[model samples]
Target: MVIKGGILLAIRYNSHRYTRDIDFSTNQMLGDINKDEIANRLNKSMAIMGESL
Candidate 1:
C-alpha cells in the first residue's frame, strides 16, 4: 500500500489540517475484497504504530 496527498504530509509534520480524506494504493490487483481480513490487518498495523482507525 502507498499513502499520498495531504494526509501523508499531515502525518509527516504532525500538524492539524482540515483534510478529512485518506488515499492508498496497491501495485497489484486485489482479486477479491475481504472485509474481515482488511479490518484485521488495519487494526494490527495501527496497533503496531500506536494508532487506531
Candidate 2:
C-alpha cells in the first residue's frame, strides 16, 4: 500500500495539519482481493511493530 492524503502531506511537507486517519492506495483492485485476509495481515504487521488496529 502507498500512503497518501493528509498524513503524507504532513510528513513530506512538514505541515501542521492534524489528521485522524490514514489514507492508502493499492496496486490491486478492490474486487480482486480478500479484505478480511488483508486486514488480518495488516493487523499482524502492526502488532509486530507494537501498534494495533
Winner by lDDT: 2
Q: Write the per-residue lDDT of candidate 2 for residues 1-53, one digit (tens) a residue.
A: 88788867876899888497888889998899898997898788768866522
- Clash-forming residue pairs, model 2: none
Worst 10 residues of 1 by lDDT: 14-23
The TM-scores, one per candidate, come to: 0.56, 0.58
Clashing pairs in 1: none
Top candidate by TM-score: 2
Quote the lDDT for 25 in model 2. 89
- Residue 7's lDDT in candidate 1: 77
